[model samples]
Target: MTSPGVAPGLLRVQGLCSGYGRSQVLFGVDLHIGEGEILGVLGRNGMGKTTLVRSIMGLLRPTGGTVELGGRAIVGLAPHRVARQGIAVVPEGRQVFANLSVLEHLTAFARGGHGTAHAWTIDRLLHLFPRLAERRSNLGGQLSGGEQQMLAIARALATNPRLLILDEATEGLAPLVREEVWHALSTLRQAGMSMLVIDKYVRRLIGLADRHVILEKGEVAWTGSSAQLEADRSLWSRHLGL
Candidate 1:
């Protein structure tokens, strides 16, 4: 299911349908992210944004459709299997271990991934996230929300994942902290780390992401470049309530 200009592999979702019990959330959602591309996922609350992430991460089983990561179907696979397949997710919540030190949290990923020479190492991650380095010994629960969010990102990078999925990366951070998080994401993009970013800041996403996909009622209603999205504010006000 290669899209025009999209290589064979990479992250591709085609007609993905998912739900919790009888409550169907995602309906025929289709989207893709390519190597070294930063793709934005945008939508208002209750629009199946997280559901799509869950389905991709194997946190939820898709009743219908396919999820192909790196040219292989990952639908119905366990979360660990999905992670092993080069997909690391920083979920909506930081979800860090309350008692684990920052160092321990990252070091736990013994089976590091991302085979490239510039793979993410703990030293590199600490350099990318200086705050985490400063709090290397601090327990996850001892950090502020922003710090925890940084830890969450650094922890995921530790796995050396080829694809990084960040759900609400800066959801509850202070303005300054939000800016920091955004800067880190931008840096990752520049470093050629493929990303699927879901943030409330639509304008920021449009500026940073190479492509944008807007979901409506569990389906992709609009997919285009930043320039295309910027030219049409109606799309924002309609699907995203921007």
Candidate 2:
């Protein structure tokens, strides 16, 4: 089902319930991201932010609810199947292959003929994150945390996904590096790339995302435009513990 009063979006989650080993996390959560829209998911720790991303990525089987991409259900599909369906996730912790070089990472996951003329080629991704270009021959394990994060995002983009989900993309990094990452994201936004961004940097998220979804205890406590969220500080304190 579509979100009330909103058109069907590129990705939609309705009454989504999920958990690990019977410990339920998400509870009837609902949110959507329109084409070329950026949706920010915000919450305090243990509030099921990652759980929601995992459920969408098909990493964890949801106990109930529906997950749809481009209006098609993908509830029980495998993780790879979900990726093939045009959803790519830059998981928390920037899980780059330790043994792979920067060039290898992009080439291995590149999805040819699936993207527009602006498709993320290795050179394009390197252009987006120039440090990665300089470190093309460097192994993933040798890069700094910020560089690793950049690579993780680049690898996901290589798939040319219709929707990109970034779980805590700027969790731990220097201020400069975080700014770099945010700049790349803003550039992607300008290019009309749809994204679901999960980051603790609410201020930055407000500047980047078109809309926001605040998750509290596995449920969507509030959702609104960036302007609305920016004007409501109580929502920030109550739901986000900011």
Candidate 3:
């Protein structure tokens, strides 16, 4: 399902280790995402899920290890530089600019030079998120939680990233809204958008992602297909305490 102009295995991470102050979070984390593949990173809370995403996005520098995007080393680059390298993140809590309008947020990061031609654009993002279009003039702080989540994703996509990394892809949202978020992800997968999705919804993730990586504490505890995950439910109960 690779797009005509898109390449596969666009992002790769090896031996990633990071933490806050003296508390180590991730240790020797290794993972990769192929073009058009939806890879799910599953684990319980405080299992270094957010830390892993932060390390890859350059929000936190890894104590040791390497991060590569499209075969280039990006381990210690700045966050802005990482973004320029075609990586975008929809962080947990949907942290949008509180005073900025919907249009302002989208246009702020619409730098299109690095992305592929015919990449995600303002019109396309608006089309994908109709609710955002309806509230283009509303301040980001005024939108509902679900709307903020949608805007967060739309804002990232507007950057035309090669890999979209979502941390806690769906958390604390109403059931119906969570379904909408998942449905949006399905649509993106069909459109050949590669993603590194972090979520607690293991049941639904098995159906959405092509591959799964379970993190125990901070290391890769298991890696396999969705079928393998289901066939071994004990695996989740053991490592994830689900």
Q: Please give, for residues 215-242, the per-residue lDDT of candidate 1 as tens digits.
A: 8888888999888889999998898777
lDDT of 2 by residue, 62-136 (tens): 999999998999999999999999999999999999999999999999996345667888899999999999999
2 or 3: which has the higher lDDT?
2
lDDT-sorted candidate list, best first: 2, 1, 3
Top candidate (lDDT)? 2
Candidate 3 segments whose C-alpha is farther than 4 A from its true place: 1-8, 113-117
Tens-digit lDDT track of model 3 for 163-236: 89998868988898889889889889888788989988899898898888999899899998888898998988
lDDT against true structure, model 1:
0.89
Instruction: Give me candidate 1's TM-score against the actual structure.
Output: 0.96
Off by over 4 Å in 2: 1-7, 113-115
List the global CA lDDT of all models.
0.89, 0.91, 0.87
Reference-based lDDT, residue 240, model 2: 78
lDDT for residue 38 in candidate 2, whole number 0-100 = 86
State the number of backbone clashes in model 3. 2
